[model samples]
Target: MMSYQKFARDVGFIGIVQILTSLSSFFLLPIITKTLGAYDYGLWAQINITVSLISSLALMGLSMSFVRFLSSETDQNKIQEAVYSILFFVTVSGFLASFILYIFAEPLATFGFKDPEATYFVQAGSLLILVSVVESISLFYFRIFRQIEKYSYFTFFETFGKLLIILILLKMGYGLIGVIAATLIVQGIIFLITLIIIISQIGFIIPRFTYIREYLQFSLPLTPNSLIRWVTESSDRYMVTYFLGLGSVGVYSAACSVGNLIQFFVSPLQLILFPELSKLFDHNKMDEVRIYMSHSLRYFLIIAIPAVFGLSALAKPLLSVLTTQDFISGWFVIPIIALAGLMAGIFQIFVNTMFLIKETKPATYINIVAAVTNVLLNLILIPIPSIGILGAAFSTLVSYCLMAAFCVHISLKHFKLDFYYLDIAKSILSSMAMYFFVSSFTISGILELFEAAGVGTIVYLIAMFLIGGFTDHEVSLMKKYLFRSKVNPSTK
Candidate 1:
């Protein structure tokens, strides 16, 4: 088993890379929205969401299963074989996905957009599924190999490539098509590059049919659950597009853009937690697993609670400066959705624990129920102009809240573990104190953001310190990590 400190460092490395990418996106969004306008932005968003749905299927739950199973394998030779086999599975899935999209490209395109030109965007976006599948597989492999530095390298390259392409094309007056085209081009390039690097690192070999079967045995059962999760996760954009039209969808998508920035912090937590928790489960260390769960929940809520409240409070000024006036309508949705992200992030840590214990059935069941509820709520609420994008945001809130509660109930019943409510309450109280501190600043735009964030950080630190959120021993460990010299800066 890896040391908690080392595991944290690895997760932090990935988190920093992800945060950089997210920052780039946040900075670029206003430029993209202004250049494309509402209708074009909406179209691009709809196409992307549609492509996301397909890519979820293209992934077919194999990536998560790959991480879990690959981490569990002990033998070097067998691990190599398993990696090659999973690679083969993903390649085949990608091809199958691309072909299906090609066959139904026209129907899928026109069904949502009702324009023939939109077909081209759909076709282009469909290819991104294959690219993303390949890229996810490569990244998971990198994680298993402990190639932390290379993982960061690929992450930045992927984000940078997409950013550069979008900026150049948007400047060239390509509009929404430019956005979709840029995604396709950049993802393709990154996928190829990562594949080449991985092949070089491992020396690729073609696996036999039995190797494929071994992977599928573990991977295939998880697909329905993955599909259900994708639906629940991406349903908001699709629901808005279907019920509210392209323009409304764009507005909600803009709101979600800000919300997704929170994921830069959450994703690395999930990545680290999933494998780490799986290891604990494999060893039957329920006590350590509970401690990790409590710690993860506390840490994430501390970061996210203020983030949601502060960002929402400052959304108007931030959007005005970062994006055009057109995007200001999304301002109202930010706080609501940001709060949703806070709840969802806490939920994700606990939900992932179910996977560790192989209690996936309940997770799948409740998510399906949640997904259905979201679609129904969108259909009922979107036509009311007063609700508008807020309705879409609320649908997500309701769905995830329901799913989170269900997951917690199931985990308790099946595993006899507790989520440590005292820890959660302390984090929440600290975060709320921090939020109020940050929101008290009387300013607007970027300056307001910096000032508020600065005050909030100091206040959060003081509050955590006063509240005894960290043990003295934990603080000493943190000091050692920060001050000690090391050959690899990441390891420190």
Candidate 2:
């Protein structure tokens, strides 16, 4: 079985980096929002999401397939061939996708954004789509080669780079298009930097086209599955745009920004989990895999529930610091979206199990079902006067919860394993206790942040104990870590 303590340690590191990135992003958003205004901010969100969708097509599911291959296969030569093949495919696909998006930039910008000036912004954003694809390819290569330190470096640089450029452009009074252009410029630099790092580590010669062609037989099948996932995840933005306008999208985007902090938890966990889980499967260690998966589910719920609740409770003040006061109107959307994050976390942990078992079509069907549900819900609800953006948030949470439930059900059917439901139940109870404690009092701005946080921790711990989530053994470990104290041999 995977060592629970060591797993937690790795998760802790991932969490730290993700938290730092999210914290920096939180500060960065307000600067952009204040400089750009809601309409312009909404345009940026639209273009970014549009570019993301196109880039997903360019990726063609190679990154995920790469990790899966790397984990399952021990043949060094085969691994090298697969790596080179995916790299070639992504690079070629990136160019093609960028070119196509550029050709249709005008129509996309006009229909994509609520503002007329968004067309000017779209031309600049075309560069972002191009650079973004390159960056994604580079990131996947980084992870496959185990260049995590460099991955962290690129992540921080790419994030801060946009903030720096945005500040420079805003200072020059270049307005909205300037802000969009700044992001593209920063992304290009990051892409170049990533390429330099990868080439230095693994030589610059392109692999033979024949090698990538062979790998495509395996990778291409996953593209539809990936697209379904993206549709479920991103279609809401489009629906919001169609129904509510760009300005409403701006508010929703801001709320999602807060909610994405929870994704920070998921992203890094996936980075560590996928390769490890794949290796475990290859070795036929079903027991170990079950244990690891169970721990991950419980751990994520333990962290995500309280984290989302705290974020939701403190949303107004958090937004005050993250963006401007005007942006605070969307604060209520934070909780709904944060709940979606929690559901997504569960889905992330379980969804790969189906793939591990090679139930690809079933997994695809589940995702497609969820995406269709999200789209239909948005179409029906976005027109309702009082529901608009709030309806979108609710739809995401409901769909995600269903998706997670379906994946878990499929996993149970395939694996003769117990999920430790009692542990999960206890974690839920603890989370609810923490949430009520934090949400009861209202103080304005960042001051209330500490107030809620302090109480939340105390309540969470007490509830965890009361709910019997921890054993004496686990409690002993906590003491050793938190207090640096050695426990005496127990008198049994």
Candidate 3:
């Protein structure tokens, strides 16, 4: 019985949490960049990419399946069945993966970093895979249950705590090792905290193996999708590191991080939208599902379009202030990566259509195509002296565009959203307007960047309003949600 207003409010709250999380990371980037320098930072990036790749593989997509299966279930026993089943499987897989990574640490370091000295970091990073799986599944439980406030608290604490620990370790002269250790310690701590909270809420249960086969059937198809997504999103860093150098990887990663700010805008919607849509689709509420899908895309574009534009226009100054001159070349890659982020966001929306219908094979197929395309293009382009990291950035943008187009086409056969072409056009035009105004300013430092951003945002909003980017009804709805008292719907 979640009302539209309540949903909006939840999205807003989660959006704030996302903003804080992004900001915390944003703030930490400079510290790490300045402290570790490009080569070490690049190594750190590769380590993280490895962690994500292995962790995703080990989870076998069970985290997503948990949300899919458990979100609408009322049977407490069945809920426990889903929860404990996923936890047990993921825990065993996680530790096994961690052990393998630890045992193969040297070769992995040599392969990924071209430096055997990185073996210690690789061994330390192996621990992250185990703890992170638990953390992820626990958070997924919070999300499926719609305990957004508790979710937000844990998310913020983990993010902020990691930053604080990393900073202190760096100050203590732990250097690159400090960063890796911080990640492991912080994730392990948060994993324990979240585990306690979940157990307290749901109590403990020895999971029956009854649902294991069913869960595996639902989740197994998505394993390739997860791996391929890793390739699309992260394998490029490995390529960059291999082709150019860790310094180049570091520079590319900086731009990618900045561009990833687009996620803060879209991810909150994606997070809330999936479970909501799953429940709606489960109940045969196709009309509501369609409305949610259409509005989700439109609303995402309304913010993301301008963000991509503004960030692209201000990339030079922003990078100059945030990172050292060594990483400033990365500014060139920001616009391409930012647009890729937008495409990634759209891809998430379309893929939800696949998730809702339980036809996940298409998602795996689409990702395979995109991931292969990205790898081939990166190999072909990154070696060309003229392209280098720009090739990686362009490869990302092209692959995501391909994925989005393919997903949209496939999703239409099952459930076609209005696509909202005109509204999207408005968003693009408004963003362009914002870009022109923002780029006109001569920016040198943080203050000027802030000033230009403020002025650009104001101009974008005024232009959007004049160009009918938002309807009166939509604006009224926003006002009602933001200014009015909370509207509590009857429990579902």
Candidate 4:
């Protein structure tokens, strides 16, 4: 049995790793935006959206298949074959996907981005798709077997390495091309390192492709689900680009980026939650699943609720500090997008039930509704001169809310778990207090922003403690973690 204390500790450690990874992006934001200005920054954002879309398509959802199919496998030969099979398959598919993107770059640049000169950038960015596909597969090997430290360290190293390299390239005046090229180069370097480690541990074997059929059968339906999810999450940028142009989309993307930090609160939980849940479910451990889900949801809400509040409270100042004056106009969208991020996180936690049970259709239907709702809303709302880019943020919020509601309702039918409404209420109250306290700060720059953020975090933790928001078990577990005690998780 995997004790709750161990699980919580892993989540906590991954949370710290996520914070550091996010900080790299935080630092990169100013470097890229300040150097490229709004128009070119918007172009870079567009390139990223394209990469995310195509990469998902190319992988064909095999990443999730790996988690579902191989999370509990112990045989070295079995793991080796499954790992290499997926890697080789995606290598071909990833390359083909990259080639297609390279071929279509001209038309995509002219129509989708409305910048013919962006053709070269789009072509260069195609490599990011190939790297993303294979690296994700390589990294998922660590995740499936619960090797959290290696996973976290590699993620952090890749993120900061990209930041440092990209900053240098941009300083050398390489511009948007430098940003994309630096990312590709860093990801390639990291992938090679990861591959070497994987081979050394498992020993090389030419995959016979024995498991590919079963993996694809289970994973293929997830492809459209991913597509629809992307529509809900990212298609808005395309719409915003079409109606408002690159500068407006750039401002919107900047605000969306800040607001989207709320989602990071859940990444740690999501990263560790699904695989753990899969293993427990496979072993017929229903009670463990419930306990894990309940605790995971509670942890996610407590952290994420405060984050949405803090980001909303600090939106304008945060944006102003991280971006130039040109990007400040979209500050209002930050709170909206932050709330959307919270909804997305909720959807992520609950939707795991669908994945665990192999009920992909319900998840697919839910995303379809969200994607349609998002598209219709964006089409109707964004073109209005008064609404403009705010419409995109609003669409994201509504779509995510719908997806969360639908997933939670369906998930409850499949299995009941503790929702802990009172704890959530306590969390919201604590977040509100943090919001008021943080709002009182007069932030003027990055240093002031970090100071306010630090103090705001302290205030929130203090308020939660004063209200007895944390359970005794949680308190003891943290004590063990902080004091570096050798915790027997079961005893705790």
Candidate 5:
């Protein structure tokens, strides 16, 4: 308990950062959708999806290598070696990835995006992959070192900075390309700043590539895992573009950007969880790992379950208000996508078991199964006139559900943690009550949507308290984490 007290505080702080990050994304969504409308907004979505897929492939799982290998290290020299070796290697690799994407941008825009004229935007957006890989590695350095303040500040800075710049560029009539330029500019600045801060803290060294082999060996299996996971998570947009059109992809992606917000409940927390769990697992503290994973899952469900319910209840009005009337038809997809986000979070927590034990193949194989299922389902479902884009949403939900089930089965074989099912039941019940209360009102605009949500939040909390949803230990920890208070456990 005492050991992870600092870890708890770190989690609390990162939690705030995630909230801000989500809000920034929410704000960005409307600014782009309303400005660019459906067709061009859909093109923007395609560009982002392409960048994400390419960048993840470029990373080669080095970020995870950084976390696993350096999380427990104390020597600054070895840390420097691992960090620079991975960074420099990724620099070369990232350049190659971006180069390929750049050269192929014409064909991609023509065939993949179904937009022949988007070639220039695709070429310009290729730089995003380079900056994304490097920026992610730099941020992971702060994360592995537990520099929570710097980490949180950078996360906030990049998010809001892009928001401000994109707003300005769009206002000045820059359109989709403006958004891309703004992203590249902000991310490049972030990479440079993080690099300077890193070198300042630890004097620079020419990377010796000593640990490169070991790192690659551990990370290579996971590299393909990223590509496969992309299939399950992002390939559906491409499928929609194929079966429908850029305009429909625009409608699908707008709703997706909202539905996927459910993953925010877990992403920031995972940044801390993976590193801290690595430190403990290296020390043979299996029990502590179990406690950390269990509590993390329990609390994630508490917040995420309510989020899924509230978003489903508000999906229609929320879309109509945030985007235009053209996007309202995509609203039903939000709840399906939100439920998928919920399952994906559960899968992420469970899959850590394989990571801890250094068994990567199983996770890779499971993702392959899920990915194939997703693609096949998209082929069958998306082209149907009756299902259309809703088929895409349902397919994603099914894939994520399958992945979560597979992970839970495999994770338990190695190390099973308490899932706190009864508490999960209580959460479901409380969220159901909030759902009913929220759905009673017809929300038209942003203020009313927020008001209903705020009221629903209070109602959920009150219901949780009434139902004894949290343990005394959990309650005390929440208070201390919230207020940053130092209270003696013996007194409690």
Candidate 6:
């Protein structure tokens, strides 16, 4: 059994890693925007969107299947069987998908970029599909095995390497093609390194196709889920490009990236929670699962609520410093999209119930409904000329809210999770207080922005304390673990 202290420590470590990974992107955004300009940046966004969609399709949901099937298994032969089965399938599918993308690059560019000359970018991005699939499967192996440190190391290396390469290529005046090539090269190198490490650790055995049927049975239902999720998350960028042009897409993408910082906190919890919960459920330890579920939701809100409030409070100033004036209007969508991201995080937690029960069809269905709603709403709202990208943001928020609500309703029918409404209320109140406090300050530059964040964090913590956000027992446990106390604190 994993102790609370150990779990907390793992979550904290991974959270820190995720924050650094996010910071890499945060740091790169300004340079990317300034170097490529709005139209080309939007084209960059479109290329990535295409890659993400193709990669998701090629994955066929096997990554999650790997976690579900292998998280608790101990048989080495069986592990190898599953591993090679997934690798073979993903490799074939990824390459085939990449080839198709490359062959149709012109049409895709015509449709997505409206400039056939940009076909080369699409073709270059196609190479990323195969390398990305390999990287994702390797990372999933790390995750299922609970190799958190290794996972963090490889992820950091990949992000930093890509950043460095892109910087060099951009400085050499390689432009958009330079950025795409950098991603492909960096990911390919990382894939090779990760595959070697995995083989060395597990020892090579020729893959048998024994688990193919089972893996496919488990994964196929999830393919639509992946596609619909893409629609909900990314279709807006395409719509913006179509209606308002690529510059609008660039601005919207930048804003959405800023708002997605909420994921920095929520994603680490997600990374840890799935395997832990899967193991617990496999052992039929429903009580521990319940505890983990409740605490995870409460803790996510504790961090995410304050973050959304803080980011929203400082949106304008933050955008001014991070993006060019051409993209500053993107700030209008940040608050809306940030809240939407929080709701999306909540939906992730709720959907875990479906996974634990091995009932993912409901999740796919829920997302289908949400994705359709998002697309329709965007269609109606974006053409208003007054609403454009803001309409897209609103559509995302509404769709995510619906997704969360539906997932909660469906999941509750199978199992009960303590929603901890009171704790959530406390978090909201604390965030509101932080927002009020931070908004009182006038932020003009990077230093002032940092000061606002520091002050807001302190104020939010105090408010949470005053409102009884943390239990006495949790406080003691935190102190003991943080200070490395030798005392054996009660885990109850």
Provide the TM-score for each candidate, comma-separated. 0.91, 0.90, 0.95, 0.97, 0.97, 0.96
**Candidate 2 structure quality by residue, lDDT tens digits, 63-181:** 77777766556565665566666766777788788777777777776666645556666666666656776678777766655556667677777777777888888889987777777
Candidate 4 weakest lDDT stretch, 10 residues: 483-492
Model 1 over residues 1-492: C-alpha lDDT tens digits?
Answer: 877777778877888898789767876787788888777788888767666777767777778777777676777666667777777777888878887887777886677665566777677677777877877887887776667788788778878878888899988988777877887787777677877887786677776545556556666666777677667667677667776777777777887888756656787788777787788778888888877776676667667766776676677766776777777888888877777677677678878766676556777788789889888887788778788778888888888788878877776664555555665576667778876666666765666667777787777767877887765655665566666633444443
lDDT of 4 by residue, 374-395 (tens): 9999999999999999899999
Q: For candidate 3, lDDT tens digit of each residue in 230-290?
A: 9999999999988998899999999899988997887889778899998999999998998
Q: List candidate 4 segments past 4 Å from native.
A: 477-491
Question: After superposition, which runs of candidate 2 have C-alpha atoms over 4 Å from their true positions?
Answer: 1-6, 72-79, 114-116, 145-147, 447-451, 465-467, 487-492
- TM-score for candidate 3, residues paired by index: 0.95
Q: How accurate is candidate 3 locally (lDDT)?
A: 0.88
Could you tell me the lDDT of residue 56 within candidate 4? 96
How much RMSD separates candidate 3 from the native structure? Answer: 2.9
Model 6, global lDDT: 0.88
Q: After TM-score superposition, what is the CA distance of residue 17 in candidate 5 from its true location, in Å?
A: 1.3
* CA lDDT, candidate 4, residue 254: 89
Model 6 over residues 1-492: C-alpha lDDT tens digits? 677667777888888888788778866887789899888999999999889999999999999899999999999899888887799889999999999999999998898777788898888889989998988998889888988888888888888888899999999999999999899888888888888988998877778889888888888999989899999999999999889999999999989889988877878888889899999999999888888888888888888999999989988887887788999998979999899989998999889999888888899889999999999999999999989999999999999999999998987786678888888899899999999999999877778878889999989978988888877766566567767655445644
For candidate 5, write residues 125-154 as lDDT tens digits: 999999999999999999999898999999
What residue runs in model 1 are displaced by over 4 Å at the alpha carbon?
414-420, 442-444, 474-492
- All-Cα superposition RMSD per candidate: 3.4, 2.8, 2.9, 1.8, 1.8, 1.8
Number of colliding residue pairs in each model: 0, 0, 0, 0, 0, 0
- Alpha-carbon shift of residue 451 in model 1 (angstroms): 3.8
Error of 6 at 475 (Å): 3.1
